[model samples]
Target: MKKTLLAVTSLSLLAACSSTQTVEQAQQFAPCTFPDSPTSEAPAWVCDVIPTDLAAGALGYAKKSAAGIGVMRKVAVNDARVQLAAQFQTDVSNMFKQAVESSVNTSTEQGAIENVVETFESVTKNVVSRSLTDSKLIVSQVSPAGGLYVLVGMDKQAYQANINEVVDAASQEQKLWHQFNGEKATEDLTNALNSLKAM
Candidate 1:
């Protein structure tokens, strides 16, 4: 009776471990799927599978409403612009942080770096909003539920230009420039731009 009990306990533990491992593996390998529109299939872009030739893209949607398609397009486009701006701000912040941390010299004061980051955080939103005027609606779809979806993107060249403009503007901030090695920081930040494209 004791031997049987031990064997059953061991089997239960083994089965639990195996099931847990299988669940983890399934989650890791699960395929990406976009939510289908009521009337149409969702495009790959809706899942953020950007094309190789584009630097960045965003997906936006508006729920079914009494508003016409024009209103829907405007709402979706604005939503996409908001998303794209947020993404750009985050990417730029990461690039700046990497530049400061990975620089050959770390003599800049920590307080100064924090201040610069704060300044950039505020300025980046406005800059990105203006830059997004250049972004175009690549495709759009209407769901069976009468909602609208839009994919907004900027080409690689235009996206690069926007990055350069943002960096250049940041470098021009007199207070930030006076706080640290502005030229060196700007150069490192520029070098990091290539990584964004690859991502």
Candidate 2:
């Protein structure tokens, strides 16, 4: 009777531990909510206008002025594009780091993985530029102070598709590297790319 009781107690403890872990994981991806008053430089509506999740592409904000409304809009849109590019770079770098850490196991493989990640980072800028050609202007308003405030959004599907394309191209490059060197030269890269695709 004591053995059965102990066994049930152990199972109950395991169940509780697993449920707590699941809740923590869910909380990590929960949508962010802004306070009644946002203290950031960005407008209060900015969070509502743009997705906080990097997987959902990126948001760019810009405030610009010019002699005419047309010129001001043009310049502000351009500035927003630059901001989006920077955000895209950061997102790609962060995702690459996560993928590499999860996929590569050996310290000896770190150098090769870093090289591939760096290459992917450089290639990501070009991919983002091409992909964001169709990005939409989500918010455009005239600030009370007299300049245009612009916010642009790129859809997550579009961003993922572009990243997939880049990964495929990089995979081809890794294939070539493998041929010139050895299969080991590209194994970490291939694993890392696979991990990214899983994300």
Candidate 3:
């Protein structure tokens, strides 16, 4: 009976020791970090470090084609320029719409506002096309699939300059409709220009 009890006690002690060790092992492992920190499951290169300029400027992506690297780069740059131009056009259009709606209440003023908006849109389209020709290429890399990946960036300052010129021209045209409308119209345009500059 004594020998049997000693064996049973030894087994119980061994089981308890194992359970404690298992818990300790689990505790030793650190908590998982995500996004910024790479994990064992995620490769280091998968965690892309975005450039500050890329973050600030408009981003455009394009894949390489059979046409060649030069063609691919041009396509990528054009894609980025188009994206930037579209964004600029949308923002300016919305700002101008808001300004006109708030400032022009009468039918006579409304006609003038419509003319000003049309002129502004036409001028903006031209400027957007011209401005993006000088946009900077931020990144170009070969993908794992053996195709080139290109990224283009355009600074807000450049876009702002273009916007300012358009606004100035539109404001001058808006002034011809009514002498009283000049100060308020100019103020609204200035406000919109300031917002673009801030961006």
Number of the top-ranking candidate, with lDDT as the measure: 1
lDDT of each: 0.71, 0.62, 0.57
How well is each residue in 1-199 modelled by candidate 1, as lDDT tens digits?
9999999999999998787786657545334444654334565676677777777888888877787899989999989988987887888777766765665246656787777667766666667866654678889977667778898888877777777677667656666555556577656544543443343
| Per-residue alpha-carbon lDDT of candidate 3 for residues 169-197, written as tens digits (9 for 90 to 100) | 55566443343355656565555545544
lDDT pick, better of 1 and 2: 1
Residue-pair clashes per candidate, as listed? Answer: 2, 0, 0
Best by TM-score: 1
lDDT of 1 at 119: 71
After superposition, candidate 2 runs with Cα above 4 Å error: 1-43, 46-49, 52-66, 129-133, 174-188
Better of 1 and 2 by TM-score: 1
**All candidates' TM-scores?**
0.70, 0.62, 0.53
**Which residue runs does candidate 1 get wrong by more than 4 Å?**
1-41, 181-199
Q: Write the per-residue lDDT of candidate 2 for residues 1-199, one digit (tens) a residue.
A: 9999999999999998777786658555424332322332445444444555433333333344446777777776777777777776777778877876775655545565566667777677666666555556666766545556667666767677656776776666643244224455357557778776665
Candidate 3 TM-score, true structure as reference: 0.53
